[model samples]
Target: MDERFNVELEQLLQDRGRDFLSLSGVCKVMPSALRARLGLKSNSRVGEVQKALQPHMGRNLEIRKAGRSLCLVRRGEKDEMLLRSVQARPGKSPKTLRNSLPFTAAEFLRLTNSLLKEGRLRVELNARCEPLLFAVSPEGPPTLQPQPLALAPVPDAEAEKAVLRAAFQELEQGRIFVRICDLRRRLGWSREAFDSALARLRRERTVQLHSGDVSAMTQEELQDSFVDENGFRMLSLTWTEAR
Candidate 1:
């Protein structure tokens, strides 16, 4: 039982590529998904198993017991790790590159975008029209570069209103958070437009972006999170009274 649960939890962390998770999140998810039934008798045992597994995780990725949560402790700078990954596996989709390390999706996006901005890396479209990341070195293919984002455009007020209304209804339903990915799918707006609106609302303090428990979300849901300058994916959206 421990083996299966442990592997599942580790994969959840890895698939989401985040550096931190809460024990509350772990306990909530493990039982629900695996139907582990975590009877009151089993909670303490689960904690102990997680603790014993910590040392082993430290080899590739380390986990430390931090109060009521688990946090990944990695050595190198994230940008350095990203460069190495791109060097090893060039021409990979953004999702592939994002999941290549122990950093959070937001962290990956920030550093990757930083590197791209610094000309340390490049992205090219593959045959399937998917963006692929490549190290910008002498050996890298000499391909035309895509246009970079200079600024987050001023958001359309209408689009911002729509996002607010959707979030409000969800909040009124007593849900603590709304998944950005779900909103994206429902809105059917261009990524650029949606991203810009999120940025605007965040800047105006109309909304606050928070990371959901990685354990509660699928890999695609995690990847679909909004990353607007913060170094972690905003998987869940909460609203402010001002909105």
Candidate 2:
């Protein structure tokens, strides 16, 4: 009887230890800071971190790669509530959605994009020419607003160029070659609009598209593009040489 009790106690302690580790790992903290606190080696790979976090996977915790680092985020009760709220209304601007929820802009974007990639969410343009998000469901009615609500005039060519330019500048600031899907999300452009703008840029030699390889492409080859299974199309904006 004493041996059994000791064995049960040992199991209980191990379970408690795992719970503590998982809770600490999921704190809303910076990756580097969390690594330091957890005493993880500085050169730990993402896969290593994920292996260390295996016990926490799918238990209201998720790991995400943010830039070059991995971060832990919670998908707990609050996140479920947020999803339900968005599903109920089914078409809100990102700003509006952010305001309605407790997430920061970055967090909102991350969560929404994840859902979109998973086909749990969809996006459409509203009458105001702003992107709105909706939840996906088989039995539900189409999420788009009726034709009556699309009374706002379409933006002119200059307006479209301005928007595209703004998006390009933002990408330049990040100093990273952006994926086409991510760029479209950043610019809030529908698929049609994004493709049209990109074709125009290619024609003008203002941007270069790449495949998995990041090497510079000649102007003639910019028109050819491919999207990977994960929906990434490497893109870089080009600058004219000043003499």
Clashing pairs in 1: 107-231
Q: Report the Cα lDDT for candidate 2.
A: 0.49
* TM-score of each prediction: 0.37, 0.35
Query: Which parts of model 2 have CA positions greater than 4 angstroms off?
Result: 1-75, 78-125, 128-159, 174-182, 212-232, 239-243
Cα lDDT for residue 100, candidate 1: 35
* Cα lDDT, model 2, residue 236: 45
lDDT per residue for candidate 2 within 90-195, as digits (tens), equals 5546665565454556777788888778777777775556777777776776553322222232368656665666555656665645555435545544445567
Global lDDT of each candidate: 0.58, 0.49
Whose TM-score is greatest here? 1
Clashes of 1: 1
User: Per-residue error at 184 for model 2, in Å?
Assistant: 2.3
